[model samples]
Target: MDPARSSSPNPATLAPLDLHASWARSREFGLRPDDALSDALVSPADLRDRLEANARLLTFSRPVIENLFRQIGCPSSTLLLTDCDGLILSAIGDTGFLDRATRVALCPGAEWSEAAMGTNAIGTALTTRKAVAVEGSQHYLTRNRFLTCVATPIFSPTGGIAGILDISTDARANLSHADALLRTTAECIEHRLIENLGEGFLSLHFHTRPDLLGSPLEGLVLFDEAGRLLASNRAARALLQLHGEFPQGSYPECFTTQWRHLVAWAAFGPLTPFPLRTLHGQTCIARAELLLPRAPHGRRQAKSDEAPGRAEAPPAPDTDPRLGHAGTLVAEWHRNRCAGPLLLCGETGTGKRHLLYQHCRDHGIGMPLLELDGRSLAARAQAGRDELEDALRQTENGLLYLTDVDLLPAEARSRLFEAAGSSHRIVAASRHPLAREAEGNGLDQATLARHGAHIVTLPPLRERTDFAHLVHRFVREACPGRPIRVLPEAIDRLRRYPWPGNISELASRLRLMLALVGDDSTELRPDDIPDELLETAV
Candidate 1:
């Protein structure tokens, strides 16, 4: 049944006399039904300022409003968003209806609290701390009698009232289901707020059944690293019958379980449902997800000597005589006490990154590697200075590998040079020379002077003598436990090609061939080569 149309008393609605009593109270507060609506409209400049101040809230609430509009909005309906104090922040809907709404000062920057607009849905919902539907004559103000409005208060993750979401339409329209829709939308916004709270928190998902553990109805409770309770979604609160602030205690205190057992379950194996009983004796199934801290970017250990229970790293590039000059340059740089930045210049797919990884492994450099693209870092720098600072902080006492150094913006490049000064080792890679870019003012000159002491230029595949060894290594890595047999003709075809995309391209081609040669086959023939590779045959 539509709660709005039910003959039984609506919990969200006041008795007819109670609404009249509210109107009497409004009059007692010196508010008149005949008051001019323009008196409540804020200046356009003030409206813009308020919107800018609430930019984050506007971003979070946009999807909810758009979704609700698609579901229930019509040519004669308007949606209003207000801050905690009942000042309209956004009003969006049908153009005609919006124009009509503005006549009653239902636009942005208009204050709609009981003192200003007199007992409307927005004000009533705020004052009563509940969902409210005020229709026609039920409005305390006579001028608002032509509209029906349903409003619900949106709550922040920390349990404070964030704002209000409201739907207002022509009173003649049937809006019996508006209250339910508004409440559902409000709950969705609240859940999203909870998910975006912060990092280093544990999320506990629980439900009456194991199958429902991750469903929308599942309870989500967050805890800090010390296992202290943080916040929870509505489903969690209802399941535990918790009220107000979560009391100071560890997670295991609320259930019949031990903290050590829960920690062991989270760290050791697959997520299995564990039995949990509330203090009230209600049984539930729960699973805990430990959100591990993000590892330094591009950090990988060498796997040339694999041991049991260790992850296998990417295959190392061939150490052929053709790369002797590059290796010598790296060795000299490592020997130098200066320990300045190193720049690696090479064409795309020429194994510059792999070469660096191999160098790190050979030199026994145990520092973590944080890899970032120049263009992406530049974009983040444009967004804010704090993002770049945070990234630099995370890479302290480690190696920062920046790829595509030529693509970094001038300002971002300058900032990066400033941040990287003497604190961390930087290894930058580019298709062109860093000195040339610095001359062009595309890169910071001081950064090049400080770090470009040893610029190693890697030879492309066409100029290298390691073709056969590289092919064998890649084949072995891609088709583990299976013998690789490449026809003589296929080998000649691969060797003669220009290899425009270089070693990376070669690795991909081999992997594809392995996929095509199922368990029944172990041979890679010329016919198995992609048509595109054959089209560019030398």
Candidate 2:
């Protein structure tokens, strides 16, 4: 059974909280308005001096307004979203109206309920709770004569009108043929609202109506941080034979097995060489957001469609089970200059594996990265007892990153030593410092002496200066339009965080945010960031 279907609140009947509030409050707040709590949560102290709810009017309307004026081919359009009262919660139009509309209160806080503006779409849509249009001369106001309007009521999941969505175009223009454009824009806005205010980590759009939202394509889509779909337009849905919603979820869990490995690419540190996958069927990559919740929720969103092509083949696990240390160390090793067989000693997430690969690349070295993760190799050895030994002998001018070097089963260690004796550079990463894990409990003179010259300890993201920008860069890359610039205060919050999962966790959190609140504007407001991110202390 599809999990989302079982959990979703039926959209037909209105929920109690949503019932009378949006429509009624439209009048109460729009005409004689006061502040309402932000959809985001905050501490008690911060709410003392809140701005009026009218502030959200134009601030929120600008995106739609900008899209109408610039993106759409329409000759002229006016956009608005209203509250219960007949006030102009927010309004935007072409330069012609924008200049004249400023003569009245139409900029942000203009009241335009049925009582104030007299039976126009903004008020009538809320008052009658139905969409309406008053064309040139049909409107009560003289200035409305040259315009033809189309409007719809947007609703909360519970069936209450959250706001009104309307478009007014020049009557003289071929605006009658634009029903498809109106519907698509409205749906797109609804999707944005759903992501901002509801449950569910993923949002998938199939091309049922291109006139409503998105381009004319039919395929599966997964968005990057800023919330644009990855690939597979509407057409992919028919191709994949998907009968249900796509997959969306929290990090390390929601994505198919492939995503976890793809994310592991973060250990490469700087952005010098961007390694992308072209063979994965579709070249669509999402600059997706972090999906971790900033607070609690009552229901969950559905999953995004996942057509995982292949599992990336990484080196085998070493004898030790230190998961992340090896990867981070490899990442760091690659960053260091002329760093010899650097001995990486640390717990998981310290990033030893990535550093090793980077080491080879930086030096113009392109040999196969071999692994004698002693335990696994030893198991295969006892079982096979074949030409495997010869393969180990032939890896000349190549790299062998031996993870859990300290746990090298006697035979594998000997092979490694023999290999190290040759020209092959054996960069071994261990969980424990060689001296600490000494075989005799005194000084591990033998093992320590063999891999002596190069030992660099790996540190977690919490201890490194590289983390802030690293975290910022990942979040920005994933969320293309989201203003990833950390608010000075947000940066202060990041500084105080003790990153347990290191870079991986940071990237994951960003993905979560991108999936949740997707605002990729050049200048971002604090609320665009997740509340948990806001709560972080410096």
Candidate 3:
């Protein structure tokens, strides 16, 4: 039997022993068959708050519920969703049966746990940590004899019970396969939850049936590069026989393959379905998705090729006044003539290129500065390998600066990496983080590790502590010979505003302010600020 199927109870047929045990537990809890159903345990306001708190869960599970309803929907039946604690978070039913559901407080805000209600499907499923079906006289409360319910717990990616999915109806309605439908729907919701939670982690898809690899029935697992399991869907957990808060150790501890072999399969044969065996010898076909590795923290030390007396030192705040400490660090790296490829990461218009120019000037380097647009280079490299070689030759013994390196095609990125390693020093700038760019451009992890060993991250203008100083400097630069004073109120407004466009935006705004003031005017006032700035000021 499949591990998933073996672990779960058959929803269509409840075992006699399990049913009797639940009844005994209900009786032990002081519940009586003659007791009337109680009102909702939580107030309306509290229910609303709970719903809002679980908004993300609801978003992930809603599609699964709707799909299940379309498959097994019946007149006079209702679908209810609840938190792990058994508080009803949502309820949707056939219009004809809605009023009946409300009379029993089977709607949102009601607590249906055995403590609050009785041995019903919702409560029993929570208590037993299994799918449950309860009907008619099986309910502990006498007033609940009119209904039947099938409920399954939805597990989180990390293996805890996140919530419950339940279908309830009039006791007389035939719910032949209600249990199976509930279990499948719960699996779908669990799969979506895992996918959402698995960002930045490698996702693995596997199934006994090859066709099911991309389907909802496939087992989904997430692991880090080090082979540490991060998360998995319910199907994956069941298939792998994993339990408790988290499965421990590396991938090989849980699965039959070594981590090195799995990494090789992911890198070299991602499209091929490889054989994966569980520790128990259950075999299946599996595929892996490898995400870009995170860039190593901190800059690498300068290479031996660095100029004499150009070793890195801590940058003083005044080196690049606007950049604060970040500018000082970049200046040190530039002065040191670090031979490794340089990566400048920041948002657009944050002066990445300007800093590069400043670095070249400070070092008194007179070699040719060869500028290459990554998109254009990618196109040339695609035409023929010789074109790429020609470009590299042109930049020989000079600084090769590639702008928007993130946009380079995969083929071009590989060629660039080879050329960068052999011919010239490369200074690349990107509007995205280097790791994200590598992923988008499909560059090899090893190439990025080798080429981008020395990385500098520039902070956006809004994050800089010297906002007032930058503004004054820009004003002086834009006005030239004229001394243009800025009103205190105008400066306050500038500081308060969030500059989405960064330093370039600040300079543009300053230029406009200078033009508005003209040579005759000496001071820029709050009124002189652009209407657009005023509208967006925060």
Error of 1 at 454 (Å): 55
User: By descending lDDT, how would the candidates be arranged?
Assistant: 3, 1, 2
lDDT tens digits by residue: candidate 3, 73-132: 587999999997999998887987878888888888888888777678898888787898
Candidate 1 vs candidate 3: the lDDT winner is 3
Count of backbone clashes, every candidate in sequence: 0, 81, 0
How does each model score on lDDT? Answer: 0.68, 0.46, 0.69
Say which prediction, candidate 1 or candidate 2, comes out ahead on TM-score.
Answer: 1
Largest lDDT belongs to which candidate?
A: 3
Better of 1 and 3 by TM-score: 3
Question: Residue 383 in model 1: shift from native, Å?
Answer: 52
Candidate 1 TM-score, C-alpha based = 0.50
In terms of lDDT, which candidate is stronger, 2 or 3?
Answer: 3
- In TM-score terms, candidate 2 sits at 0.35
**How would you encode candidate 1's per-residue C-alpha lDDT over 1-538 as one tens digit per residue?**
5222232223355544545555655776677665656578779998898888776668657765775676674668998889888899988898999998899989898998887888788988887767888887677667888988889898655565778899999988877877866776676666656655554346677777443454444677778877777777667777777776433345766666776666655543214457778766788888775553332332222222233332223235656675888888877776663466677888888878878877865775544455565655555655534555655674554557777776776665555655543556667788764453356545444656754446788888878877766776766555555555666677767887788778877776676666766766667777777677767767
